[model samples]
Target chain A: MDSAGVLLDAQGLGRFVPGTQQWLLRDVSLAVRGGDRLAIVGPTGSGKTLLLRSLALLDPIDEGRVLWLSQTISARLVPAFRSQATYLHQRPALIEGTVEDNLRLPFTFRIHAHQDFDRRRVASMLEMVGRGADFLARSWHDLSGGEAQIVALVRALQLNPTVLLLDEPTASLDASTTQTIERLISHWHERTNGKRALIWVTHDRQQSTRVAQRVVQMNAGKLLEGT
Target chain B: MTVDGYIELKAWQVAIAASLVLLNAAISLGLQLGLGRSLVVASMRMVVQLLLIGYVLRWVFQSDSVLTVLALAVIMTIIAGVAAVRRTERRYPGVYWASSVSVLVSSWLVTSFGIAAVLQKADTWYEPQYAIPILGMILGNTLNGISLGLNRLEDELVVHRNLVEMSLTLGATSWEAARGPVRQAVRTGMIPMINSMMVTGIVSLPGMMTGQLLSGVSPLQAVKYQIVIMFLIASGTALGTVGVVLLSFRRLFNRNHQFQSGLLTAAGHK
Candidate 1:
């Protein structure tokens, strides 16, 4: 990826177990450029989720810094930065509401106060995943695992975020649903016209190879390039 | 001696009241409940503590000094604040300070208002007869509210860590992300007061009103005092619960909208 196209960059980022010398993520540096598809694969305790969280600036970093478009992020810009770089959890958490309420949640936030929730935009996005607009009215408890993940994806994608940090989003889903998610993500990336990027953390090597153009490995709180 | 139509209890009469605790211990022994020792120890502690407080209150009332009354009130508040955080299952490093400040500010504010405004018949705002009892009642109720609020806040945050973080990653400010837990905590804190208010008169006579009646106060005057005390307790509890919850929110989350779940350790865990 070209340096000028870099959207999210981490420089020697490190996170330790609060007061102990034990490192949870150490000396991890990564550069995510526009339209880049990167996957981080590691063992269960290898800190892949921590690395992704660090990149998203969701966790406190004991050392190093994360930059947005080559500029170091300040506290004031964190909300805006998060709006543009959304993090997706492995187990989707929907509020106690219908899917439409979940989709409208982001607009309720102060950071997104100026934005309006466009029903037509969300409906068309749902259509891409082969779901009808009627699906939005489904209660959160009624959604199947695959369907909940779809709502989560549509919720994040509707915000038009520049970078998506996904942490094993399909780790528990079946193969068919996983492919659908992969297709939906690729379609979203394609629609961004090379101005969007995604960092997918997964355990399945075949899935990584299928979705990511470049794959990195994590082990013992350290990042290794090229898998 | 009988004074003002109120019967005074003799030392032997008070001992008769103390002896009832032995019956509780006897029942514990009979049932093999393993609470005999605890029951005896708890009753003894209560007797000793109340006696000591009785003496201290007597001395303060005799002294008639504003400093002594205010000092005692402060001591009661600090103890109440510490006791409030003691029952929480999850706590952070600053939980005690947060609880204490919440209890102190809310109880004092409401008590001061009661003394300076509602009970203006008192010779002084810091009159020991008026201030100490009012502050103590407010502190007791405010302590309960702060404890419940702080406990519920930590519980919700810990249990719903994922949901809270999900909101944060969606670009929510800390206040926005924590709205659910905050609301729940405040509600939980206020519930006890609300329930008591609902049943205050019809269900049972409250302790203060009952005490006033036994002390030979007229029924109507006692009812008025009870009403004021109830309102004071309610406001104190509400203010304290909200103050502690808001303070905890500031401690648990930072300006960057990050939920520092790591800061919360299970109570008694290293």
Candidate 2:
């Protein structure tokens, strides 16, 4: 991948809850290249989610700078910044709309609002993720957690984001669905011509080795050296 | 025969007043109890606050001092600020101060413009009978709105953390990530007011209009006043909900673009 793929440069990031002053993430520094597959593993309450949010730019850091294509960016530009990278939530949440609505959500934003959304393209994306084209017309309530997660992933993929942040993307899925999504994600990573990066957070060590090139372990808000 | 000096009370007059009190009580009760303890306490607090305000209004109306009326408005806003702060479960230390300043500033600006300059036919710009009641209504409605917007926004901030992150990573600003949820929060917060508005007159007569009729204002005059009050409520709610939500957004997130966990602690039951 060329310089166009160098998605993020995050340094000296720190986050403290406004009142309790608990350091959810403190002085964490990370640089992500395009196509880098980094899995973040941590104990519960260790700010793994917080770190994902910071990288995704959903939450703001108390100290540090996040640079996108060398522009000084902060919370104000989170949506625009993150659209370049998709973040799959720990718990999949679909909007109170139709299946097609969730799939079309990113395109509705001003950042991606102008992106072309065609039935043919959306159908292919669904099929690639092991879903049928007819699934697009289904009601939001009908989807199981695993189906919702896949749909969320597909929605994020629609933007062709340079980075994908997965927060336990398969935690709720059955073994078969997990394997299916894992395989599909790996295939999509290659098809992007190595133009994209994936940053996944999970507690499952086996899933980490299966899906990630490098595993970064976190505990008590600090990163530990790998085994 | 010579006419008697005493005014005669009509049967319909007593019925209207009784219904007004009952309806107000029921609506207030529904909001307080159905929504949870915060709303209930809020209703009680509103009663005590308005009653004290009634006494203050008497004093202000009897006097002609502009400063006293202005001071009274300021005091009302301060109370509103306290309510906004206390309403949130995970309130920051400076929340009260922020809410107070925002409410007071917005209310003063809106009320002064709406009444003094636009509705300039009043005897005095600071007339307590007119200005105080209007100000109280505006401040009271805005307080509820800001509280709802803040509480709902905090909830979204937690629940939609990843959606926000996804947006942020994609080159969205923090405000952009939070924008959808913020807009949702404000819209949801406005629902109760909007629902009441939709059902007004059809479901039940509103309180202020009923009060005016019982006090001997002509039905036409009371209806006109009710129309004006409804517009003001909508206007104040929009201004207050938007202003508070926007201002608080800066504090709600960190420099790193994470929603502050402390906000969750401050938010009371949904």
TM-score of each: 0.96, 0.76
lDDT of 2 at A3: 42
Q: Is the docking of candidate 1 incorrect, acceptable, medium or high quality?
A: medium
lDDT of 1 by residue, B1-270 (tens): 888878998999999988888888888889999998788788889989999999999999999998999899889999998999998898798988999999999999999899888977445887788899999999999999999989999999988988899888988888889999999999999999999999998999999999999999999999999999999999999999999999999999987778888889988886
* Model 2: lDDT of residue A58: 63
Candidate 2 lDDT over B1-270, as tens digits, reads 122432465667655755555555677687775544555576679768867966777888788798998888878889998898778755654567668866887677677766866578455778777788788888888888888887787777777766665555444556666888789878965777898899999999998998887677788988988988887877787778877777778777666555555555534542
lDDT, candidate 2, A1-227, per-residue tens: 24454668777888887546888788887777867888888788888888887776665467787778767764456656667766778677677788898776666567776777777877887787678978998888999888887877777776777777788989878999898788768877887676777888999999988898999998888776554
Candidate 1 TM-score, C-alpha based:
0.96
Model 1 error, position B126 (Å): 2.5
lDDT of each: 0.91, 0.75
Residue pairs whose backbone atoms clash in candidate 1: none
- Candidate 1 ranges with C-alpha deviation above 4 Å: A1-3, B22-34, B121-123
Worst 10 residues of 2 chain B by lDDT: B1-10
Candidate 1 chain B, poorest ten consecutive residues by summed lDDT: B119-128
